[model samples]
Target: MDTTQTGLPVRRGPRPRATTTNPHVQLDQNAPAELQDRLRDHALSLPGVRRGVSTVSVPGTVAFFLDTPTERPAVPDILGGEWGHIHPHTDGSLHLHVPSTLADDLIAAGWAEYHSLVSRGILPPIVIMLYGPRDEAELAVCSSIVEEAYLAAGGSRVDRAGRTLGLPTP
Candidate 1:
């Protein structure tokens, strides 16, 4: 191992590929292909959101995570999400975060439920793993949920995606 400028040891071997246990390997969530494409397209179009690349990403999962520099949020509050993001997996389910109010509302409406693993360590309690957008209409609802999460993460959705757009001048 060699120490890098950041004072972390670096491995000097062929890098390994991403791996996953994939508990849902046999469970396809039944969302259509178009919906999956739409979700990916929309997420990349949002400001400061991008295709996720991490040390550990689940195999066969398409993730769009927030890339904005933001202040961490205080729970029971909705104004900011420190690192909000979403993963629309092959199983047709969703894993994401939204402000607590929206999360509660989604749970009430039967659109989603909490992922018990969120708070063990990986994500904050405010982040929940959503389940089931089993159809087109449900996918639309899913889009809105994603929009809210992205917004909470301090992302904007102008056509430029990641660029800052100046106000029109006189």
Candidate 2:
């Protein structure tokens, strides 16, 4: 006797391909043309740097993606006392958002640092994105970077899951 449910055969194998289009699969609508140009220019100013993907919008913030070879230095002086906020999205990607005011200084300092690093024969390329409110979002992103560096200097208190994971008080 054939074992079937609802008069359909049970086939065990790879799932079939999806034929319908997902309405959400569209270009990033947040990014604007002028903002794109600014992000590109700023990122290019860094030494030994290469361009990365960026998107900007009026309500959203600017973002950069640097393709560096080595890990970024832990400069406490540069970062005030707060590492940038880090979030693990549902897609498994980590998103770090630094404040705008600090973001500007960080990028400037980053360029100087990058040049110094290159002089020492180190190639550290970074991707940077700027995002913020329509009026002053760029500044906000830069500020955030600085804030993050500051936080790093102080030390991170949270865990990978965004939960508090620190030593017990003695």
Best-matching candidate per lDDT: 1
What tens digits encode model 2's per-residue C-alpha lDDT throughout 1-170? Answer: 12132221222222222112211111222224444444334333333333333232121322333333133434322222112221111111112333333334433432111212222443222212222112234323333332343232333334334643221222
Give model 2's TM-score versus the native structure: 0.25
**Scored by CA lDDT, what does every candidate get?**
0.50, 0.28
Q: Give the runs in model 2 whose Cα sits over 4 Å from its true position.
A: 1-31, 52-72, 75-133, 136-170
Candidate 2 CA-lDDT value? 0.28
Candidate 1 per-residue lDDT, tens place, 11-128, comes to 2333222112223121434456667667667666766666654222356565665645343432333223233333434555555666776666655555555555443554455655
Candidate 2, residue 62: how far the Cα is off, in Å: 12
Task: For model 1, state the Cα shift of residue 48 in Å.
Answer: 2.1
